[model samples]
Target: MSQEEKKSRNGGRREAEPERREKKPSRRRRRAGISGVLLYVLFIIGVSAFLAGVGWVAANDVLALNKPEHTAIITIADGEKFGNVIDDLKENGIIEHKSFFWIFSVMTKSKDKIAAGTYELNTDMDYRAIITNLGSHSASRQEVTVTITEGMTVAQIFQLLEKSGVSTVEKLNDTAANHDYKFSFLENIPLGKATRLEGYLFPDTYKFYMGQDPLYVINKMLVTFDAKLTEEMRQQILDSDRTIAEIVTVASLIEKETDGTDQGKIASVIYNRLDHPNAETAGFLNIDATIYYVTGKTVTQADYQGVESPYNTYLYKGLPPGPIANPGMVAIRAAMNPDSTGYYYYAMNSKTGLHEYSKTYAEHQQKLASFGD
Candidate 1:
């Protein structure tokens, strides 16, 4: 009875072992399926994270958000390439991720829309704002206020314009020398010299765009001059023996000779010498400032004798070829109406800061000697 029971138990144990082995493989398969599903989910998560990072970077540059604050004058030269502009933006810290910006520009068709100019750009400006600012409109251009003083020469004015970022000196000089302005005053002034329009550019405060065209700049001054010389003054000039050029030349002399106090008195001396050629003066105006204009130096009497030029009034009989400096309205007015006097000679008294006039050469010499001349 015991042997039969042991054999039945052994047979049952063998069958149970096969079932346990089958169950072990099922559990292993379930664990393997679960691990495969977990790995697939992790891969999807990683891909999503990478795409999110890329999107964030693109959005940052496109929106110009979270960028460092910066302001720069972006000068886009004529026919400048878009790639070079992108490089400038990157260099100026106005933009990051230039490739992304370039792609954005291409998509928006902003590359060809940008015009040549100087624009004030800042990091606060979005990509679209930056592109909009680079257009040809006046609103897009940066402005500068320049004051051309009364006594500034054409060369000095051009240099100041260059330093003020209004325009380059080369451009100003080219326009001044070549452009033929249609004006009565400029009609006699020939081309090929920048100083031809020197006496006519009305000195005043002007507002100009950075990188402005030189033609427009010169035209503005010419127009101002045309407006400044009134109809009354023009008619008076026509009625008088002197032409506008001569009056302006005389005014330029008066401007250099005297301060604001005695322009009319100085004009009287000039007219006395020009209208009435005396034996002592020998028809030579003998003004010292004209020599300085030729040599561009502080001329003494010794320096004057050495200088030989049409502009040297000591050597020349009459007025210089053109106005030595652009005269202000006061000097111009003084030239229009001279003081009634017989004075043919004048000398500036350094201590008194005024001119003492004399009728004769001997009296002029005495007055000059009194001033320690």
Candidate 2:
């Protein structure tokens, strides 16, 4: 009886142990599934929050919202890279995020359209408006209008242009000396010094952007010179056995020497001396203005022979290498058409406030000596 009871009890205990192990595993599986579902929900919520935060920051920067009032002058220099411009905007507090703005610029194609110049920008400007404000014709860009008068020297004109903030003197000189301007008048003119385009930069009023390109500034003046010299004027200059350069050089001398009324007579006197090279003047124009052009000061008695520049008419027989100053159309016309006269010498009469012409050096000296009385 004891052996039968022990075997039944052991078999029932083993079956019960298997059922308990299966039930325990089911309960543990339910609990683990619930924990995994909860973690998945939490991860989704965290990701959504992070994306929303990033979107909010990007929107604020694009729309320029919640930014302090800040005004700054952003200068995009000539040949300045767009990356450097973005860095400047970031440094000036005009933009908060450089990478976002750069991406936005690429998307909108604003990087290629933005012009190089000084522009007034503020923090209130959105990314789009900032890009627009820095454009070529934007009103935010500063401009200055300058009027160059007649007879102004190249150096003086460059200085005036620099003072007006149109461009720096160094940039102007470099461009004038090196930039190959496309114009018929500037064709034979070599590129080495700023004075190469001296007489061709016609004087006129011009409106230029602050920090504008030096080539553009110089081209504007050359275009004016081309337009001012009509076809008729050019043909007349070419008809004579002289280059346009020589005519301009003679015109410059006439502009500086004449008292505004005697340009034709002065022109005649100049041609008479040049035509008779072996006369008493001995092929020397002996003009005092040319000496002044060399010395940049009033010519004294010693300067007539002291100065050795090619521009010195006392030293050089023919025309100077180039123009001494920019001449007006009136003086240019006078150079083209000289009055018929045999006068070989002329002197400015201090008493009459006009030039007194003489056919001989003796008469010229007599008139000069009488001016002192």
Candidate 3:
């Protein structure tokens, strides 16, 4: 090539190379801009997805999920594990998801605080509210209060139990007859009677949960009786030279014999008659209450002679075989500590519901004539 032609071509090539470099940079910039736009779009999508996930978790963990309308009872038994409780709650439709509850409990540090009891829960409760309810003591238990009055017979007490829906009469009677109570007072209770533990069921108001076992109710009553019969009372019975059975039997008679005001004097009259050498008429006790106990009705003159049971104190000389009815603390205390009186016979004033005492049959007759029964 000629020198002039080479120089012109080289100059033209250099100018074109500068223009090519500029074009290359512009192409690179266009590609970089497109990549930047794509990266920004991806970042926005990731952020939206993260926000959606957070919203889902909050709805499930904190919000009130699907639940039923009415309240349902859930029994969390003793020593139940948290996993088992969650399973129970889920199975009972109290919660839609166990995982959400588990996560929420973990976050709130309430997994170990769940108490064991019978909880009445409603679907309107949120997860937090339900957790709070289960954790508290008073919110978890359902109780029924039963008031047993003084002098209630075993049959009457069982009837009250059946009426209160605490237990059936058959179940309560069976439990009272067969269940082996651990109380010291129950050690001497004989077996095979119609109502073996008849008078030992302490008369008082009691609070029991619905659907509790019949044995549990019986045990509670017996335990209450044990608690009420303090150590001093037991020692008093021992010092009186009488068995506990004798004292309770006498107390039951005293409870039926008169109004509660003069139990100590009535107890004294009973002791005087029992110790009198020629007191056969009064020593027989001829108690109308025993006849009522046997016949399940008021004692008539014929029933005094015709009744055949050993519980008929009218014919028997000593205390009855067992207590005829449950006596209150007053009668029990009166029996244990009788007043030292000389009276051996007594009659109740029909209008006054009070007793008139006498040392002889003629005096008793004069009192009855005065009272006009």
Better of 1 and 2 by lDDT: 2
lDDT of 2 by residue, 102-188 (tens): 999999988888887766677789998999888855435588899988788889899999999989889999999997775777789
Candidate 3 residue-wise lDDT, 1-373, digit = tens: 8777877988845334434433456788899999999999999999999999877755854576443353445667788999999898877667777888898899999988889875656567888888988887652446788998878889999899888888898888777777666556667786554377877889999877766667667767775787799999899888878888888888989988877799999999877777774774656777788888879987677758778889887778867888889998999999988999988888878888778888788988888888865
In the range 171-202, model 1's lDDT, one tens digit per residue, is: 99998999767677877778999989877877
* lDDT, each prediction: 0.83, 0.84, 0.79
Off by over 4 Å in 2: 1-135
lDDT of 1: 0.83
Q: What is the TM-score (0 to 1) of candidate 2?
A: 0.63
Highest lDDT against the true fold, candidate? 2
